[model samples]
Target: MSTTVLHARTLPGDAEQRWPARLWGVLAVLCLVVFLDGLDGSMISIALPSVGHDLGMGTASLQWIVNGYYLGYGGLLLLGGRAADMLGRRRVFLIALGVFAAASLLSSVAASGSLLIATRFVKGVAAAFTAPASLSLLTTTFPEGAQRNGALSVFSLFGALGYSLGLVLGGVLDGFGWRYVFLMPVPLALLALVVGWKLISRDRRPRPGRRDHADRGRRRVR
Candidate 1:
């Protein structure tokens, strides 16, 4: 698959920034990761009424579909945030991306309303982990104020676009079937998964600049 190519090209990271070209590619990939979270929320809203009709659900039952995602996402975000801190951000991010993608796949094919709701909860919980871990990666990567700000601007832009596009996407996809709304995220998720595994640095933290410190100390001594 195309993912195999992505992995082969992305590994053996240039921590020295030897290839600025590759660095940009890596940045774009990470930005794409956070975009998915926003898109999912907006996209599902557009499809919900149709989903309710197709699945034969009442108002109370339909509410649970959205509520379930929020419950899992909101309830466990604190725990997920702590885990991202204690565990490696890269580790949590990759695992969460995998879980989200798997849950989405399962959700798209679910035979019943109950199964769909359960999978949505799983997706939401995974999002909590991925979001914080991704932001951590971004901040760590571009530690300087200017660079970090630029990266954040790009990241936020993607998130905003994802939300705006989701409504249009949901309406289009819903015309075919509500299931396509679940399916919509698959390609984006898979690409992020591949790039996350390959492009995201395993060594995400920066080392202290002992050389600069030494220089300052020498000047002081003189």
Candidate 2:
């Protein structure tokens, strides 16, 4: 007697079918958010001379202005990722974006160099939350397939573009005023917030019944 071998076949889930449109929109918003993040990261560097001259910042204070933001951003990244997993990525992303925008506005209006630096620190904290949430949202939303690969590629390209564009935009805005350099992200961030809220699905915890059903289905398939 000849035995036939059966190859295991994996089926696409409901999320794979329903989430593509929403996922695309979310991807666009995330790209923009990351772009703004990259822009802000470099913009300050280009505008530092003007900022120091205008605010009459000494050398030590100038170093702190940049160092503070870096320290804050690095310190909060892991915590932010955990928060996104616990609180839900979309919720955290929106909240972070809002915080970032508010901080940017504060930096724009700050009266002293110290105040502006403080706002930059706050912005860095907000970015820590935004960056991880944005990426996590994309990963969770898309399933493993050509689609997911394409989405990630696009996301990476946007990040790189943002980094490069930051220098150019910084030069243009810095020519106007150092304040413009800080204020530039506000509108884009607002737009990203609006798009993200509209496009990203709320992260729901898996219900017990759903988990049980999945387990039962797997057993039956076996």
Please give the CA lDDT of all the candidate structures: 0.83, 0.86
Would you give me the overall lDDT of model 2?
0.86
Which candidate has the highest lDDT of all? 2
How much is the lDDT of residue 93 in candidate 2?
Answer: 95
- Which segments of model 1 are wrong by more than 4 Å? 1-19, 203-222
Model 1, span 1-222: residue lDDT tens: 999988776764534334376557767877787788888877888888987888887778777878888888788888887888788888898899999999999889987789989999999999889888888888877766666788789999998998899899989999999999998788889888897788778854655599989999999999
Itemize residue pairs with steric clashes in candidate 1: none
lDDT of candidate 2 over 47-107, digit per residue (tens): 8888889999987887776777777789999999999998989899999999999999999
lDDT of 1 at 137: 83
Clashes of each: 0, 0
RMSD of each: 11.1, 8.8
